[model samples]
Target chain A: MDMGKGVGLVETKYITVASHPHELTLESGQHFGPVEVAYETYGELNQRGDNCIIVPHALTGEAHVAGRHTPEDRVAGWWDELIGPGRALDTNKYFVVAANVIGGCCGTTGPKSTNPETGKPYGADFPLITIRDMVQVQYLLLKNLGIRRIKAVIGGSMGGMQVLEWALMYPEMVEAIVPIAASGRLAAQCIAFNAVQREAITGDSDFKGGHYYPGPGPIRGMGLARQIATITYKSDESWASKFGRTFSSIRPQDYYSLDNRFEVEHYLDYQGEKLVQRFDANTYLYLTKAMDLHDLGRGRGEYREVFSRFRGKVLSIGVSSDFLYPKYYQEEIHHFFKQAGADSHYWELISPYGHDAFLIEFKKMSLKIAQFMQTLS
Target chain B: MDMGKGVGLVETKYITVASHPHELTLESGQHFGPVEVAYETYGELNQRGDNCIIVPHALTGEAHVAGRHTPEDRVAGWWDELIGPGRALDTNKYFVVAANVIGGCCGTTGPKSTNPETGKPYGADFPLITIRDMVQVQYLLLKNLGIRRIKAVIGGSMGGMQVLEWALMYPEMVEAIVPIAASGRLAAQCIAFNAVQREAITGDSDFKGGHYYPGPGPIRGMGLARQIATITYKSDESWASKFGRTFSSIRPQDYYSLDNRFEVEHYLDYQGEKLVQRFDANTYLYLTKAMDLHDLGRGRGEYREVFSRFRGKVLSIGVSSDFLYPKYYQEEIHHFFKQAGADSHYWELISPYGHDAFLIEFKKMSLKIAQFMQTLS
Candidate 1:
């Protein structure tokens, strides 16, 4: 899994946890894991190890947060734009770490991973894991790397969910927390979208009740799910600006033909097909379900009460056009942080990319992160 | 199709047009028909014959504008609340007529109708029709009924598109026009949603190239499409207020189970299943495609130029929270209508039901329509 050349100098590494007699207990009270996590690191750990920044990957992201492992790899890391030397993350000044979450398929122990007991892929039998469970695994990974205090835990979308959990669960261990394009809990509309996506996968005849592995898999269903998701990742303004009413150059001879008519249709199809090539369908279901279960005050009290536990300097960022985790969600986090007497700040990235602005608008994000980090003593 | 008791006196009737010796030509330059339009009328034609108001059905709508055909019928006409005596259309004072659109499956010539050439169901082979084509068919139906002049043409959603077309295509015949929750042209985001829905239906293996009729049909795909559509029909605020984060009463034994955990999920599923029971998948595809092609200015110069031909009063209504056909779309229509020197009025319905407000907020709509009608004569 070489990420390619001339990208970054970081290489992915793995650590095994809950192995042997130790099993990982999930939020569902189900315990069945000898889990392994694939991670990547940049820069060098300092004497105090306080400069270590924990970067968690989003739902479809991987441990390869920056750089290319091999020259032949066409695509660089997901956050390659902001994670290199002198970049927003500035690997030169900070020790950065990113890992694939518990239910992710990118070199992590997930549904694609084989169960030691049954010697078979977990598939639908995989235990349900939550955002907190993912953070716990990353905690173990950080401990294994001999790191204790974190300079900051920053991420966007699902990754931001983990950042929130880490800051809340280990307030003293983290000095600063930045959660971008994320909310304290999944909104009803967000949950509805996720539900339809899951239905798309599960309803596929090829899914065979999530046992479609070792075959063609639910490619069509997964593609359709991706198609649905890609729409939400972008805003109406972005789509209109990028691929308006312009018909596709490849027009069908018959006006009634079901060929891709609009350029936007072709773009969505391309995105869906691209994701199907690199991602696992079952893991998509698992991760999205984990997201739907992400409520900071589930068993806790009010949101402000839960956020009060974090003493870190909070820098919450929101995307103006992000309908998935609208700006109001970020504002709530900032409001609660300030109400709790914590040092908090909020910045909105004005972009039409919607929830995906966090990924696309790297230059602006990097500038904001750099400025925020400078004030974090 | 008996519409049961406790309903108004309207009874559905059908008229065949472009049948046998005559074939209907579509906007796409393709021809195929022997089209039948199912219509229902309320009230009587006045001596002047100028009190006839044409009401066009939206996508998935029918000819039953009010009343029940039988005592056992459970579902009344879609616009029953707004078309009865003292209501919006005011059957007491106006002769209101509603007809199933040309590409509809509700007793109309559509994908489910028999293709005279093949003597089989048209299915996917149904020629693509547009808003203007649907207006043309309705025009023939109106002419057959011996109604040479229309007091007004009013509708919402796709129906609204037809209303716009009717005012433009038969300007001299229509005295007033009302288009609700609709635009002169489909936006990129709207087109994108339609494209994904079509993909959902066409991708279903069970679809068998839209030849699933006489079989189980593409029930799963159609259901998924409906699920996706139901989300756009309502606002996020509406869903949050109605369903919130409340989990379904039936909790899964395991947190990981793919059960419908949220009330919104269950609600969407119910809607999907409900639509599957009555609608044909191929017709959904055809109608959506037709909507995507609804550009009033197409082949006609600018919007103002096309609208200038109508010497009628225009009352354009918009829902405050409609994301699919936002208020801006309605504003555009009003802007152009005024620019073209037509007498026009714009009303915004304050509602949380999103695009569905036009269908659900009947009382507000009725008041507005009543006021607008007073100025029409």
Candidate 2:
């Protein structure tokens, strides 16, 4: 019942797939076996088993999607605000499911996962996986759960990438898809930022080429990576409004000291430290690289051809201030869906929170998702 | 004269200031002595010595403002296109001087410079300096050159910060000021990027608390910092146009390989390696810290009050794509100059190069600078 720090919802469960001869061959031609997926479910599956809704999570997100198991639990699931009985996800009406993707650290098969072959932690030996691979793993999990067609699959950012993949790979399985703050292909700037973060992790002497686990690990590198990522996650307007040029109250009034003088610096340092405490450095590397390799059209012929196969209604949402996955990306997806003559709707969330708006401005997102859900009915 | 890689024009000169017993007191109340400044001059000082134009270099810029001493010199001075004969700066008509800043590595007294007291490098012991301190050093150099007043002072980015400082700290001495692609105060996002870069350098175990000079210093960390910074110096539009999601031609066609996939990654890696080769990591820390402390109205009452003291024609130019020092920042400077009722003009350079447009896209900047010079006359 304690659930521990970063442990997902109290009801979170695990399913192991691709064990032994059923090894999952990745897009890179490498295979991983006995992959474990941590997930949580809410509400009822219903008689028809068609009311299930899968929710994929963004980078650093866990399997927990709603509710706290223990009374002393300080944090609820990430989507606790929107996945309750009367919320947008409306657990009373829909059976909601959220799963930690492969390459994630939170009880999911990742760099920290043990390799059955070597009887050692995979570490750097974890085969590179893609958004498609993650979606395939989720599909296998859903199949093993005895679910065929899902009512909807909703996600944002990297989760959105998974949503896109789900619609493309298993078009007949999902009735609706909501991909928010995501792109068919990540922009060059986004890739650049991710590349730098990977460099920060690898450059650390503590990283030891991603084999630094079972020890203190590359905390400094991971912390620095988190700091860089936190900057891209928030908009300039958001930072200006929240911190501005205000100096930290605790710091001395030394004019040109190297110590954190600005409140923003202090905030970033805190964010970095927070991530280092909870996140694994090797997992960070693997997952970010997976995000960077997310190109839907890769190995696929034309994007229009790919979208044309999807029978589900598409609801694409973007944040106006989101630079990481800009509004244009969502628009592009909408355009492709429209080109295919598929039922599609595009909505832009105007917020100063940047790429993080989907998580922060829940009211607007909740309204949109609820409206989209009605169309699915 | 082979001036060496990254060295300024052959005509560059040096002058030692703040020698022993006359140590320069920095904004942080720390003192440093035997400070040497490297500078280069174009054209002659007129009989009245009033044809001088002191140009302050940016964060990584050197004293090279124009021309090459030898025809075989592969790289000309940074602003060579704008500061030559009949050019924007018009070396034929006006004397132009560009000096390396106090905390700069290029022939200036910086962290790499030896401490007279310790007889070793200053390294981390180098006193924290501000933009005002840099301007003061240039002021001393000008005084040593027997120049009472200059025709104008011109700079962009960090150089622009120095231009504002020079006008405010010595109003009567500068006749005109041209600050391009700069801000009165660094925005929170800028500070955040700088903080990450500093963390990267300091986090390097090889950094050795900033005393990693005269040996293999924090090259990897410095490289990573430069990689992060290179992204900021460019616009998303530019990166898309130049590199896009194009894969590196040399890399294998493996779908999910960890190697540099995109051309942008290769470009960033090249930029990082280039900086690590020539630059001192400790100097990078000092100079970036100086930039972060740049506040025109730090000790001064208000922004308007600070601008009112500058009796000079102000021409503020901004790159339309510059995110680091956005056009909005330049507009703010122009606003304050106009509020003070000082002669001011604002121009925006339409370019995809972003913050680096001042260095690239020379033709447009050249014409603007030429027209502004005519107005000054």
Candidate 3:
């Protein structure tokens, strides 16, 4: 229960799918191929290769699920707290694969990836991707790695959406799915948030129709988008406790200037600026689209029917203060599983961190995740 | 109760305050002079002069509270639903005066107003005003109108904040005050939302340090700011009901394009674009600053002590699902009144309209306001 940083110095590995003409037909009926998936694995694959958990990254996350790439890499993986020896995923007992999704801009192929045919970065030519397409790329990567069956697929936020898709796309292969802080469909307000974020990015004169590469294009817009998004990721309680109208130390005497920063404003500006450096505006646009388009029942029948058809057990967890994906959404996902007669469990993480509780409340999340996995064993 | 615009056509009137050297000192110790307040009045002043209610407008709202400016105007005032001959503010019973806040971009003198000191628009030179300063401006306008005692002050959102401030500033003149879907002080999240909005406006390259006037300046930035503000204004239930995952009718086949719009996104864009035509970015920045600095217990002691000192009766109202201000905010306001042993009533308007419920739920708000008024009579 207290395993910490046991998965050490894990290196990212890459594999290609839909090579040459991308024989992969997208959900949009379009053919896109030659996708490179960047992934990292922890623990060993047993002879049966059945004890493997796939850790899907959330939006803006990379394939580093645990451990540091180098001793000086600053910090461990994004989910380093929950996926290691004796941890929630318990790398000691199960192999774990974490991947950068198809439309991501990390080491994976995406809008910033070079197009094989044109021999240039895809840039604006990147196809609109769906959660299912992302799941499909992972499937191909798994197939190539001889990961014929996954013990469980676990993730939070957009990662949770991928977990849901994994259960639907490869039911027999995924024995269980733990989707945390996710929704069957994006909420209208969420879509609106995404719209404004996109607008902020593209509204920048330097955007140049999303071809603003080779420069820090639309940094201000991306910063604004991040600031907006950062607001949704944290709750009212979190902000009140952390900031609460406290003026910033930056020129404390200048309250009359429009440039005066509230502590919260400073936090938002800092976050926005920090994110733009490691992230791309084009990828942000593409990933949000995938998220907005994420629907468990899209093209498929009702979520109840689709979930009922899946043989895997489901653990849909929600953070109580997650306004982005409200707690009710996780209940709806669990309800769909139960109504469809599939094995289901619903758990709410009582935290004020909002959508970010999944990443912040590691102890609570691990405890619940571990308990849910025990039911299957 | 169904007055049905009985107030009829009303003309907006203006009054000046803080003439030279800004005889009025702001909470920031800065002197802001020659503030022209735009206001509209309903009903005639009764012989008792005690039957009057001062209405304070929310951010971006003008003083025209309950009637059409022109017979040809498409719609009546913003809160026309609750103020008329037989409405909540009932012109037949009580005189109601509504004024645009000092930082507002309405007919009121604001950032867009010509500064008599230099014969140029204040632009960014507008002093940082607080809810208290706004109340002072209203007091001046009322004094100019030869109005004395007031029956009540009622407003929602930022209006509600002013109502709270009115009770504190002029405890004796204001008898009863109703603050709906408002906070005693803005929540940190609300401040954060305001921060990003200000960021969006100022982030615009054309903002040019807040002097981008006469050229339709920062249209995109203002649009983005509005889009963000619009999202926070409504509740999740309202958005899902109004525009759940619906695609826009604009070129449905081109979902792959980054330019593709979801119905909700289109709605946000439309709202953002529509607002820019009337509102100025500098005003948005200034007004949001005022709201951010709105703390009921700033220079005063705790809210409990402040309310304890005020002799006014308070009817604090909250919408059930107002996430921006949150219903707990109203509860907090009511709790302060109770803890201070003051005459107070807390009424929750059952609404999924969120912070906007005060504006959208007219019938319920009217009925509650009428019921609250009867106690004083």
**Candidate number of the best TM-score:** 3
Model 3 / residue A13 / CA error / Å: 1.1
Q: lDDT tens digits, residues A30-89, model 1? A: 775688999999877888877898899898999998888887778788888777667666
Off by over 4 Å in 2: A1-10, A249-253, B1-10, B249-253
Interface RMSD of 3: 1.2
Candidate 2, B1-377: lDDT as tens digits: 11112223467798987676347887767766778899988877888878999889888889977778677888888877777667788777788888999888999898898877788988888788889889888988888887877899999889999998988899888889999889988888888889999899888888999887688998888989999999999887888788778886564656466653677888888998998988889878888888887888887988567899886899999899887887988998998988898898899999989899998988888777788899875
lDDT of 3 at A376: 68
Model 3 lDDT tens row, A111-226: 88888888877889988889998998899888887887898999999999999999888888888899999988888988888888888888888888888777778888888888
Would you list the clashing residue pairs of candidate 3? A18-A34, A22-A33
Better of 1 and 2 by TM-score: 1
Q: Rank the candidates by lDDT, best first.
A: 3, 1, 2
| Deviation (Å) of A236 in candidate 1 | 1.2
The local lDDT score (0 to 100) that residue A258 gets in candidate 3 is 66
Over the stretch B280-361, how does candidate 1's per-residue lDDT look in tens digits?
9988998898888888888898755887888689999999988788898899899888888899888999999999898899
Question: Using lDDT as the measure, which candidate wins?
Answer: 3
True contacts kept of 3: 0.86
Model 3, global lDDT: 0.85
